[model samples]
Target: MPRTPQPRTAVLASADLSFRTRVREALTGLRWEVQEAQGGAEALAYLEARPCEAMIVDTWLPDLEIQEFLAECEKRHPQTDLIAVDDPGPERGPERTQARSPRRNEVLLALRRGQDADHEPQGDGASWNGMPEMTPVHDRTVVREEIFVRGTAVVEATRPGAEPGPGTVRLPELIGEAPAMLEVSRRIRLVAPRAATVLVQGPTGSGKELVARAIHRLSPRANRRLVALNCAAIPDTLLEAELFGHTRGAFTGAVQGRIGRIEAADGGTLFLDEIGEMPLALQAKLLRFLETGEVQRIGDNDPIRVDVRIVAATHRSLAEMVKAGSFRADLYYRLAVFLIRTPGLGERPEDLPLLVERLLARMAEQAPVRRLSAEAMERLRQHAWPGNVRELQHVLERAAILAAESPEIGAAEIEFGETF
Candidate 1:
């Protein structure tokens, strides 16, 4: 009898068991022995102990950064082909997928199968027994594919040095290409045309005010004034008057009758920042105004009618506050007619490169533009980013200053602030 060939061994490394199972099933019919590892450290250890023909790594790992792990794999086990899968979530597209294996079709098919399993609809007769058709091989160059979902509008990903499709909504103010940021832009477009109340919820420094400005700019009242009031900045004693205006001699320091923020924003929009910090008593007044579109000034008998769309933003959870009796339920419902949540920097780490580029370009307006070294970018990727995008801006500013005469910022110049 002739000698039999040994089965090629493959490793599936991920923190998600379902992802591993799906990929394993997809590769079942092939002549391969599949091994599972929970994280990068475990996978690395396995590769050292036993030789594998190929290894599939997840973009996120519990024990190591994806970039670091990939670099190590290249340096140590250069013979083993590597393929990394991004979070198979609906929000993220398969843009960063890279494969050097001759069995690239099998790898891509396995990836597609995993993604399909993730988005499998309930109670539908679907079969995964058939092999997926691979894209025709026209050239060695791989073109990027990006899907930006906006209200049933699918804009294909643009190639490098190519213009974006006309259907794409270009938001110059928002400097991120992450799925979370794309969703924010979609919501803005959907709600901007209407006069609905918008509640922007996010952690501090997550660009809530920027969302408000974008809404105002896109609204039908764009030609009119956009009046903003910081509910947390003004004292409770003066907030009511500042919001509803006050007649002369209404109270101490009431120099003259002035139009309040609401009145000033008539036919436009009124942005109330830190609305969660508003006093319960003032909440009642604000709710009444929202319900009737009327504002009653201090020492005034008549209630003035005002037509202003309300755009409120808060870092705190109004629902939790309502449960705690700090925020009124009725007012919360009124303000939260339409809600938009801004994701934290930690939630969308993939956008860091684009954000860094845009922020550095903006900083160039005041100073010479400085490029970030690969090591510096890797350092940024490892941070927790508890302060979100605002903190990123501050860090970059400090790094630029620290770089001094140098045109490029290095890892030594990148400093992170203490997280409370």
Candidate 2:
């Protein structure tokens, strides 16, 4: 009797759904079980949850840095065979994915061909572009797919390349083909046409402000002034006066009556940042204004009506704060009429290359063009990025300066620091 073949399990860590799909097609046979992860962080989570014999890291991960992910994968799961699809060419990378498999190259190559074929004008859900189409496959560990409404997209979002489809809204400011970021873009498009309040939630440096700006740009009041105020930045003693305006003699420093940010944004949008830090006392006043559309400047009994749409953002969870009594439940409900979450740098590792490219270009405007060596990029991808995209920009800026003598930033030039 023939001996039974042992079942081998593997993990595919990538933010690209199309890539994930292609891999599924390629590895159809060989009695392999697969686990899927969206980013490096999520990949680690999957690994922690269970062990797989082999793990494949796509050339670009959306969440955690790719180099860092590979390093950490090896360190934590040394027994798990690690495979990385090389940059500049994914076929070879997947070919490396062919490791130890009798028909490894065949499957990986077929996957690559299928991917390249996906780019053609194949009417929706058409054939796998003339490749030796393989049967559909699914992951043993469930995969999370980006939910897109009609006016939306997914991992295959049109970048500089990719066939354009109908109802596709392009947001060049926001880069990253990850599902999380794509969902955000879709939400912005759906809500931009409305005047509803949007509360953006995410960790610090997660581009909450960028999300707000995108919403404002897409709103009906795009031409109107966009007034932004950081509630946490202002002292509690003067937050009220700052928001609602203060009469000339309202306070000692009130040299002259001035309009508040809310009033300043009349007929436009008012962005309230760090709203979770807002005082409980002020929450009542804000709620009243939201209900009545009235703003009363300090020391003035008269209330001025402003037709401003409110868009609030915070790094902390207002829901948790509400339950803890730190935030008003009523106000939280009103402000969060629509919610949008911006993904952190660690969550969108697939965007690292684009971010590195875009950030370097911006730096190039003032300084000489700078490039990052493969190692430098790997260093960046591995980092946890608690500082998020903002930290990414700062790190690149510092690296560019440090590498001033050289045109390319190498791993030695890459530096990491913690910020409170």
Candidate 3:
């Protein structure tokens, strides 16, 4: 019997998730498998752990010096082919990109075609071969930490307007090593860099917004603003103006033309919370903008083009709404290009201990950090957790405050608030 050849594996070392996503989406089905490195260090480590056939190194590596990394690769693994992807020219900001693939005419063609698919008309359109271009992963000059897990690399992006300082805390804490939590992280890795819209579905308080933030933090658009608007919190009367802006004479209260949330979030992400609550009329306008990338201010004839990524979250079932004619089927399909679900607290009880620890840590910044007794923890796990993580945090905060000057919170101190 003839032997089948093993598929070759390749490594992609880059801090830019957008670039990585572009390459992967372009080369959807090739003989070789692809792995990712958060930065040069992770890539080197991955290469050492198991030698691969090739490594695609991005120009702006966050963790290690690009030249030094290239030298190390050349010296350590002389046999592994190296293909460097560089920016086409100077890019202005985090999201601006003009990339050129390896000089070697190999798998890069697939990438070029994939990128062309992004800008070209949907179907029957071939990738533009005339311009040998790659999306530039621009202005990533800062150094940061790298975390490698399983077969993927994770790195924090430097966001504009919300840069973290030495004393600043990023996320309160993820607080889970369980499989469910790990899977959430994995999904973030897969979807963060892609330009596709992401719909995060979960019960209220299951940390859907947190998942959205994680995706933005890991995306190329991190440096740009992440505008979060709660559809349910805002009144239906004002939702239209809030989303699409209004010209000075459009409505009775309109004093001046104002850019709406969609316009404000250009070149970044717009997180729509409780999307199921958005009015059906507004859904039509939103669908128009999604289709044309153009927003028309209320009572304005001109349309404005704004580039924005949509990360929508809702506890309600949109599928049910679609069937019920509450949500437009077309708009639902546009928003759900990619989907991620946040598990409710009860679904992953094993994470309760870590969750308690993180919540207590967050509470410490406000008050003294307290420890949970086993009895208190057991009482927590015993509850149904109908409200999920948000409910848990509220209970813990109340308990911590009620504990007063005590160093330890007893089971009696843990109170279950009004059950959802």
Q: Which candidate is the best by lDDT?
A: 1
lDDT of each: 0.75, 0.72, 0.71
lDDT of 2 at 166: 33
Across 1-420, the per-residue lDDT of candidate 3 in tens digits comes to 998756667788765556677676544466567787655545776787788777787655543345546666777887676665642322433432222233334556655653453444423453221222222324542221222221112333222233322222222224465556655655665566567899999998898988787677656576677889999999999999999999998999888889999999999899999999999999998999899999988899999999999999999999999999999999999999988888889998988887888778868887877998888999999998989888899999888888889999889998996653
lDDT measured at residue 335 in model 1 versus the true structure, 0 to 100:
96
Off by over 4 Å in 1: 1-170
In angstroms, how far off is 59's CA in candidate 2? Answer: 35
lDDT per residue (tens digit) for residues 1-420 in model 1: 998756667888765567778888887656668887655555776787797878888654433346656767777788787776753432465533333566756766787787775544434433222212211213321111222221123222222233334433434356566767766765665566568999999999898888887777555465577789999999999999999999999999998988799999999899999999999999999999999999999999999998999999999999999999999999999999999999999998988998898789879999987999999999999998999999999999999999999999999999996778
Off by over 4 Å in 2: 1-168
RMSD of each: 20.6, 18.1, 15.4
Q: How accurate is candidate 3 locally (lDDT)?
A: 0.71
State model 2's lDDT. 0.72
Stretches of model 3 off by over 4 angstroms after superposition: 1-173
Q: Which candidate, 1 or 3, has the higher lDDT? A: 1
